[model samples]
Target: DAGVTQSPTHLIKTRGQQVTLRCSPKSGHDTVSWYQQALGQGPQFIFQYYEEEERQRGNFPDRFSGHQFPNYSSELNVNALLLGDSALYLCASSQMLAGGDEQYFGPGTRLTVT
Candidate 1:
């Protein structure tokens, strides 16, 4: 019954550096999605992974990338980070069904770029 979990609850980095975030999906979940949320804004989709493949992506730049493991866990990677990249990185998990799919989000990793 464990829920989605993220690592390094808080991270601070200098501009132009790279960072990687980790996520473990909830039990019985098969799909994983990544989102970015600014301080006062709602979560914006980064990308989604299912069957170890990227199923969908958002309007993010090429610097954003991700991977889904066979166990349904996932990792989000950002390269050439910029100051504007500071935000909360959220990981959500859900079982993709024909209908009635409910997604549960993780606590989120706070990223600060200087």
Candidate 2:
């Protein structure tokens, strides 16, 4: 019955550190996707998970990783963070329907790398 949810609404970290963000998918949804939105730019797809497996990935480096849980929740991890990595991280959930997949987005986690 819940929509997508993300934790630690905001975060601050120093360069070269690591951070992990968490998300819970909406009820009846089976897919989770992550996106990064930099200032003055549109969101960029980070990766997607379906059936607890990574289904798609974007142009980010290996420093970006994610995991999808059996319960359809997810986590996004960034390692060796850089100042440029600072951005708003969003989590979206979707489910396949007769029409198409309908996606719902969560309030993003704002990450600031110092």
TM-score of each: 0.96, 0.95
Window of ten residues with lowest summed lDDT in model 2: 94-103
Residue 34 local lDDT, model 2: 96
Write down the RMSD of all candidates, one decimal each.
1.1, 1.3
Compose the digit string of candidate 1's lDDT tens values, residues 32-105.
99999999999999999999999999999999999999999999999999999999999999988734168889
Q: Which stretches of candidate 2 lie over 4 Å from their true place?
A: 97-100
The digit string of per-residue lDDT tens for model 2 on 26-75 reads 88888899999999999999999988899899999999999988898999
- Model 1, which residues run further than 4 Å from truth? 98-100
Model 1 residue 26 lDDT score? 89
Q: How does model 1 score by TM-score?
A: 0.96
lDDT of model 2, residue 29: 83
